[model samples]
Each structure stands twice: as C-alpha cells, then as structure tokens.
Target: MSLPRIAVDAMGGDEGVRVMVEGAALARRRHDRFKFLLVGDEMLIKAALENHPNLRAASEILHAPETISGEEKPSQALRRAKHTSMGMAVNAVKAGHAGAAVSGGNTGALMAISKLALRTMPGIDRPALAALLPTLGDNDVIMLDLGANTECDARNLVQFAIMGAAYSRIVTDLDSPRVRLLNIGTEENKGTESLRDAANQLKLAAQGLELTFDGFTEADKICRGDVDVVVSDGFSGNIALKAVEGTARFVGDLLKRAFTSSLRSKLGFLVSRPATELLRGHLDPNNHNGAVFLGLNGIVVKSHGSASALGVANAVHVTARLLEENLIERISGDLAKLGGHGLGNGRAAKGAAAKDAAE
Candidate 1:
C-alpha cells in the first residue's frame, strides 16, 4: 500500500520551525514511505530542510504567513483560520490532500479549528481528547475526555468508553482491551447517577462489545496494569492527569536534591544510575507526546506545545499508525451497535418520562 502524506504546521511548537522540520526528517528516516506537507514560511522551512537532506526529498512546502500564538483565545484564533499555518494544515486533511494533520500549537485553537473544518464523525456529539499514558504493563493505557467536555451525561461517558477502547486496540495491538471508568471508589453504587447509568448501559452493551467492561477503577489504580482504557469527564480526567505529571516532576526534583546533598548520597546515586536511567526513560513525557482528538471526521493529533524534535517525531508516528489502522472506521463500527440514537438521548428521554410520571 502507498504511504499517506501528513500535513504538519512547521511554525508550531515552542522551539519553532527547526524542531518541526528536524522531527519530520527523523520520522522519514524511520518510515521511509512517510511523506510530509510542511506548511509555514517557505524561506525558513527551506532553510531548516537544508540540514535534513532526506526530509527535503520526501517533503513539499506550503506557505502560510501567519501563526496562532499559544496565548490566543480560541475565538480569536478561529478568525485567522484561513491564513494560519495550523489552520492550513488541518484544511489539508479536510481537502483530502493529507491523511492526517499534526500540530504542536495552541490546544484550544487546534481543537476549535479542527472541529469547524472537519466536523465531528457521524453519531458523535463531540470529540474527546484521547492520549496514551505510561502503564506498568508492557503496553500503554488510553485515557479520554482529558479536557474536552467538563460536564458529561451517562450516554456521553459511555461514548467515551467506546472511543477509548477502540483507540486502545489500535495502539496496544490488543484483540480485546480491558476498560474501566475512573471513579473515587470501585463499588457499583459509589458514583453519581450519570456514572451509575453509564455503567449499567456499558454492562447492557457488553455482550456486543469486543472489549471487556471491568466496571469502576479508582484513580490510584489506573496505572496498575490491569486496565487498558480509563474513561472520565474532562473535569476529573484533566485534574488527575495534571496531578500525575506534577508528582513525577516533584519526585525527580527531590531525588536530584538528595543525590547532591552530600558525598555519601552522590556515591549511592552513582551506584544506582542504571536503574534511575531506566525509570527516567519510562517516565519521560516525550516518549508519549501525541494526544488524538477522537470522533472527528478526519484524524488530528495534538503534540505537546513544548515538545522537542524527538517528541514531534513520536506525534507523527502516532498519526501514521492511526491512519494505517483505520481508527475512524473502527470507532464508527462500535457506535453503530448503539443504534441511531444520538449521544445521551436514551437517558435524557427516560429522565423526562420520570418527571412526567412524578407530576
């Protein structure tokens, strides 16, 4: 099969065009069939490509004079969608010129523009931010609604579960992934009505699902290697994700202080350098830089705004993999089993009926 070409926003990321271009080169080396449509200022992009001869051979450039700044509001960014590099890259996918679009630009802007240009997939009310997180198991776990919808109903949560499970299957190479809902406790009745309703519905739909619905899982146990996908509302999922990242940085900093506190501690650190290096590799966010906007008509992978060259490459790798696996098709198949009802429609209608009976 012919490889798909990716549209990249060359002016995105904290490190600018150099990192994006170099990353493309690295990805090209690894996946020789991968092609690039680098969109940004042609002169600068060309200069950066001079250092990467291989990438220059496999890539083409599209000039986009403007760039969306990280601090710009989504509304403000949308107005410039026609002229910005991020916007053009996303438009490339909508135009069918590229299979996917990758960017390390403003998260809110990227989400806003992508939805406007590509729209949501059929039967999907909204798209969720699905990201790969490190787990103690051999494979990574997929988490969703990281910051998309702060408030979700029972049906919305159920949709996230389905989307997340589909993503897990592709990334982890698993036949049947084990999914769990993130909650304060694992008991059946511990959460709100929405959580309870979603859980019941998942159980009802489990017979038709290709994945195993493992009920509820606590936040502390998400990385225990037992769960393959963790679903939650954007409010809670975002908090949990941030807390985990902060804790990792905290521990690393504390260890650095202890190791340098004295000669004895420094000697001990030297003795355990190999083990620490392995741990660092596992915890490095760069190894897992891509966060996909699932449920969109076209694939859009969001890279960390502060990503390095290798980090951007990893994001590109994720985009290619999703396209190869036909992620959107897989999600559509699972959604079809839920009937033609839109997200949350069943539960909403039921609630209205109950109110009528009470009145």
Candidate 2:
C-alpha cells in the first residue's frame, strides 16, 4: 500500500508556518512512509520549507489565501472556510487527496469544517473529540467527548464508548480494551438516567461487542492506569480533563519550587534529575498531542494551538496511525453488531420509556 499523505494547516498554530513545517519534517524523519500536503500561504510555507530540505522534498504545498484566527466563531469560520488554510486542509481529506488532516487552528472552526466536509459516519450522530492521556498502566488511556457535544443522551454515551474502545485498540495495541462510563460514583444507580441507561445497553451487548464494558469509572480513578477508555458527555469530560491538566501542572510547579528552595534541596534535585526527567517525559502533553475528532468519515486531528514542533509531529503521527489502523471501519463494524436496537436507533429511548411507565 502507498504511504498515506497528511494535509497540514501550516498557518494554523501560534508558531505559524515555521513550526508547522518543522514539525512535519520531524514527523517525516520518524516515519519515512508519511507524506504531507502543506496548505497555507505559498510564500510563507516556501520560506519555512527552505529550512527543512527533507520536508520540502516530501511535501506538496497548496496555497490558501486566508487563515482562520483563534477568536473566530464556528459560524463565521464556516462561512469563510473555503478561503482559509484550515478549510483547505480539511477539504483535502474530503476530496480524497489526503488520508487525514492535522491542524493547530481554532478548535471550533476545525470541528465545524470537519463535520461539514467529511460528515459523521453512519452510526454516530455526532463526532467526539478524543485524546490520549497518560496513565500509570502500561499504556495511556483514551478519553472521548472531550468537548464536542456538551450534552449527550444515553445513546450518545454508548456511541462514545464504542468509539473510544476502537481507538484504544489501535493506539494502545489492546485487543479488547476495558471501556467505562464516567460517573459521579461506581454504583449502578449513582448517575443520571442517561448514564444508567447507557450502562445497561452496553452490558446487554458486551458479549458481542469488541470491547469489555467494565461499568462506571470515577474521575479520580481515571489516571490510575487501570481503565483503558473513559466515555462521557462533553460537559463532564471537558471539566474532568481540565482538572487533570491543572493538577498535573500544579504538582510539577510545586516540585520545581521545592527543589529550588535551598542549596541542600538543589543538591538533592541534581541527584534525582534522571528520575525527574523520566517523569517529565511521561507527563509532557507534547508526547501525546493529538485530539482526534472520532466518528467522522475522514480523520482530523486537532493539535494544540501553542504546541511545539515536537507536538505537531506527534499529532501527525496520530493521524498516520489512525489511517493505518482504519479506525472508522472498526468503529462502524462494532456499531453494526449492536443491530437496529443499538444506541441512536430509538432502542434506548423506547426501553427507557417502558421502564418509566412500569415505575
């Protein structure tokens, strides 16, 4: 098979064309099988490419006259998408010119354009924003619906579980990842009606599904590295993710302060430098920089706006892995096994109504 080509929004990130081009070159060095479609102002992309001879050799530039600003609303961005760098990059995926698209542009704009251009897959009503988070386990955990749909029904939650599990299989190399619904407590009746409903449905289909639906998981237990995938509506998922990010930063900062408190502390820090460096490498967001828009027909990865070249390369690496694994096909197959009674097919609602009537 031919190497997959990734479409890049060279002007999207805070670091602009230079960082994007350098990142692509770094990614190419890691995976020689990858090719890139650099979409942005030709003049700028060319100038950046001059610094990366290998990237220039492996890339094809497509000039986009305009670029989307971070402050632009999704509505306004959609209207001007055709003329924007982010838009052109996404269009490349829709046009089948690129297997995947990666951008560090405005999150809302990227989501809007991806949905409009590639559309959602057959079984998913909405695409979920998923990211790989560091865990204590042998592999990182895959969490979904990070910020796509703020409010989701039971069916939507179920869909997220399926999508998250499929992603885990590819990225973590787990045959049957342990999937869980995020809840306030582990009790079966602890969460909202939607959470309970989704859990019941997952249990009913667990034996046939590709993943192991391990019931409810709490936010605190998420980083313990036991669970493989965590599924939640965007509202809770986003809050939980932010809390985790904040806590990580706080701890890191505290450690730095403690180490610099005095000469003795600084000596201790020097002695433990190797261990601290290892910990830092594991916790670095740049190592896992891709937040994928799952359930879309085509692959789209949202890189952090402030990400470094290494982060950009990691995001591109994620796109390559998704393309190589055929993640969408796996997700579609899993959804298919649920049959007509699956989530988003009125089955969950009908069952819920019957239960309510009985009560």
lDDT of 2: 0.91
Question: In angstroms, how far off is 201's CA in candidate 1?
Answer: 0.9
Scored by CA lDDT, what does every candidate get? 0.88, 0.91
In model 2, where do residues sit more than 4 Å from their true spots? Answer: 340-346, 349-359
Clashing pairs in 2: none
TM-score, every prediction: 0.94, 0.95
Candidate 1 Cα RMSD (Å): 2.7
lDDT string, candidate 1, 1-359, tens digits:
88678999999899999999988888778778888999999999999999999999999999999999999999999999999999999999999989899999999999999999999988787789988889898988888889988877776778888889889999888888998888989999898777777787787776677688999999898777889999998888898888888998999999999999999999999999999999998999989999999989999999998888999999998898888889999999988876544323466535633543454
On the 0 to 100 scale, the lDDT of residue 270 in model 2 is 96
**Predicted model with the maximum lDDT:** 2
**In terms of TM-score, how similar is model 2 to the real structure?**
0.95
lDDT of 1: 0.88
Q: Could you tell me which 10 consecutive residues in candidate 2 have the lowest summed lDDT?
A: 340-349
